[model samples]
Target: MRLENVSVRYHRRGPWVLRQADAEVGPGEVAVVLGRNGAGKSTLLQVTAGVLRPTRGRVVDRPRHVGWVPERFPADQPFTVAYYLTAMARVAGLSAAEADRAVDEWTSRLGIAGFRRVRLADLSKGTAQKVGLAQAMLRPPGLLVLDEPWEGLDAAARDLVPLVVDEVLAAGGRVLVSDHRNETVRLPGARRWTVAEGTVTETGPDEPEDVAVVEVAVPAARVAGTVARLRAAGHQVLRVRAAGRARDGATPGVGPRPPAADDTALPDEVAR
Candidate 1:
């Protein structure tokens, strides 16, 4: 999707939250919005998700299925958790049977099954946040926008966030998220968008400075699997060297050898 010359303001003459912002995120890509609190990161995400119309420019090519989870869920609603999600599923065009199935599946996956019958207002902040995530993902979305998704999550839920992102990416969906708790370290290789002073700037992909590269030797037959495992763990594989040359230009073996059970040589996992 593309945000061309986007801008926003609450009132006709109020201070602009975002001004002349331009950005884009393609299929299967993830863009992490960054800034101090109230720096308009949410505004940019809203525009990207088509939840807010830009005061000036426009968002083009937004997907038909856009899953949006706000910073705080609207727990003031009278509906129960199950009722709200079921209603949202229907709104997303699912049939009665599909809605029920979806509600069950998502509530189970998000660990909110115990609160299914509880009213929205009765749930705690973390439980309500889980409901928010479940509703947005009632169906597979082409663009998933999450604003401060980690605000109320526990340790288990926090870890699940990256796995959820991985599923979306695997399905060729785009993900846009705003994080304040440094919880974005798990989303390796995501592009960064900084919102500040009523402006949005794309700072390119996230690349951490403190990093070390390690070499792993695997059999020719296991090379692909090893690389895939490394990448899934958020480690970038710089290159696949042949058997003749090691990192220090020394020969380690004559040909590829079988990898040991604990063959991994990666010291640390970093962003792509």
Candidate 2:
């Protein structure tokens, strides 16, 4: 899927959404979109999923199309949970019997089988979100666009979010998700696009750990080289402590231990 020069302008009160931007997502790849609220994150997903029309530019997508889980799903009618999913499948053009089968399959997968006949308005927010998610994945569209799919989900449903992600990839589907809350996902070789101020940039390496620094005692002559190597290896460096100074401040009997007896020579930080 490709979005070329896609910019959506809401009104004359200056731009409230996305600016001219380009993004390409490929099958078998999961691209997590990160941004602050009102940064056009949800707008972008809607455009990608063909749910919203852009004021300018165009979106090109492969056949087998896209699936979407919006921040809000339509369930205001007097329909049961199963009935709602069946309606979505029917809108996607499934046969009546086929749609019912699909609805049964997804409802069971999402653990909402017990609530199948329950009214959508009576279900909790988390349960409603599961129904929305199941609707999005029932046919495994070529592109999956999600806007905070994990919102309001219980712990168990939240745990299955990654599994749903894996399913999309397993079906050779590409995904673009706007995720908040600093979710830690291990998407190997996945591309990250950070959306801020309506511009998207692929971020580089993440920040380092929060451990305190204790200097490594090294030959002064090699200190600079050693520190450089350590930084390259992703370690935070602090001021070096001289070996002589260490001995000078040692607790009385602790000074001048032989190498064979110096089992505590290395500090815990360095040992690990």
Candidate 3:
């Protein structure tokens, strides 16, 4: 999908919030929109999601099924969580049975299954955000747009955002997301789209930083689990290799070695 020379403003005489913004997101690609507060990031996303019409230019080749999740979900609706999601699923072209299954599947995936009977207005902000996410994903859309998707989500829910993005991309869909918390690192290789002064530009991928390379030897069976634990703790593991045979028949485990004089040391906990 592409935004072609789009320009938007609230009124005819009002200043434009987006000035001739031109951008494209291709299938299987994730674009992360970045900008300071009030820099028209939300407006650009709204335009991409087709929630608001552009005053000038057009959105071309947009898919019929586009899912949009706003930064702050409008949870003041008078419907229960299950009802709202079911309704949204039906609106998205799901059959009655499909809608029921979709609502059930997503609520469980989002950890909101316990709140199915609770009204939207009564749910906590984090829970409401989960509902918003679940609704957007009722059907695998051709284009998925998210604005501050991580806000108000708990740690587990926050971790689920990237998994959803990956699912869409893996299924040959496009994803466009706007975030202020520099969380794009979670979506590795995502193109960066920066909005500034009412203009949008695609920036090149950031260069990787230099860091001390650590090689650890672990049992082949434990390599996967060990790497996951290290990465979860914010340590970058360069690689893992099979331990060489010990001449004395001792069990080989990863033991810390002192850092070189010019190299920075790993954290104490990690080293141990």
Q: lDDT of model 1 at residue 57?
A: 92
Candidate 2, residues 140-244: lDDT per residue as tens digits? 678888788878876567657766887888888987777664442433345677778887676433443355544356666887789656644545343365555
Sort every candidate by lDDT, greatest first: 1, 3, 2
What lDDT does each candidate get?
Answer: 0.85, 0.73, 0.85
The TM-score obtained by model 3 is 0.79
After TM-score superposition, the amount by which residue 222's alpha carbon in candidate 3 deviates from its true location, in angstroms, is: 22
Instruction: Give the per-residue lDDT digits (tens) of candidate 3, residues 119-202.
Output: 999999999999999999999988999999988887678778988999999999999998766555677668888898889998
Give the residue spans of candidate 2 off by over 4 A: 184-186, 203-272
Per residue, candidate 1 scores C-alpha lDDT tens digits across 1-272 of: 88889989989999999999988899889999989988999888888888888899999899899999999999999999999999999999999999999999989988999999899999999999999999989999999999999888876686678878988999999999998776776777799898889888886675656776555677788887887677556575655766654434445654345445698754355434
Against the true structure, candidate 1 has what lDDT? 0.85
Top candidate when judged by TM-score against the true structure = 3
Listed per candidate, the RMSD to the true structure in angstroms reads 8.8, 12.6, 7.8
Sort by TM-score, top down from the best: 3, 1, 2
* Model 2 lDDT, residue 212, Cα: 53
Candidate 1 backbone collisions, by pair? none
